[model samples]
Target: MDDINAWVWWLVGAAGLGIPLVVTAMPEFGMLSVGAVAAAVAAGLGGGVVLQVLVFVIVSVALIAVVRPVAARHRTQLPELATGIEALKGKQAIVLERVDGSGAGRVKLGGEIWSARSLDGTQAYEVGQEVDVVDIDGATAIVM
Candidate 1:
């Protein structure tokens, strides 16, 4: 034990924590590894075991208690974005073919052809008419 240095032990601890970080993909382990490195620096500078341990504990706990919540908050937040077919809903389309609710019709939506149907089953749209997209049923668009 006397042949090896205390800083070496601290470095080994950091490496041990790093293993879990890579294997489990847990950011907490990476935080702890940083603390271990800080402790190793203290040990290399002749810090007492108590001081080194205090540095490690304070750093690790502080990172977990403070940074974790902020990181989690940012991670869970999503930008205000409408994606996929939902983006097409409520948009206007030009009827390329006569649209009858009970009949297959085509519309030019977002510069592409899309199958369209009337919102009301009895309603119909004429060719070249512009209508609002109401909903989507798979590949079909419901327009009003």
Candidate 2:
């Protein structure tokens, strides 16, 4: 019986260490249940309970300490907008329609038609004129 108890405690400690690691590696299933189950097993085994608890605590803390900073740094590095209109900045476009002082015209940018405005507000741009995109206001491009 002593041998069986020792084996059981060893298995419990191994599982206490392994469960958190698996949780850290594959967190899509949610780590709470795995942690709770590991904790319950550690508590029920009784023998080497302190060692098992320490192992679990150490593994959990190590995982958090290592992964949290990487996650934070990655979050900071990602662009705020992933797609759509924000992707059109700095592209060269051609004037498809004359832009008058009223800020009304059409531009062909990225092979797509867009309502356009001039930043200088000077002479109106004629059709077939090439323009540089400065900013986007809704569906309109402020051009130069």
Candidate 2 lDDT, 5-89, residue by residue in tens: 4435545555665666586764422233344345556656663657556655655566566766777798689687746666788
TM-score of candidate 2 on Cα atoms, chains taken together: 0.65
Model 1 spans > 4 angstroms off? 81-86, 99-104, 116-125, 134-144
Q: Which sections of candidate 2 miss by over 4 Å?
A: 1-47, 79-82
Best by lDDT: 1
TM-score (all chains, Cα) for each model: 0.73, 0.65
C-alpha lDDT of residue 140 in model 1: 92
As a TM-score, model 1 comes out at 0.73
Candidate 1 lowest-lDDT run of ten: 78-87
- Residues 1-144 of candidate 1: C-alpha lDDT, one tens digit per residue: 899999999999999999999999999999999999999999999999999999999999999999899989999998578899988989999999999897499999999999989989999999999999999999999999
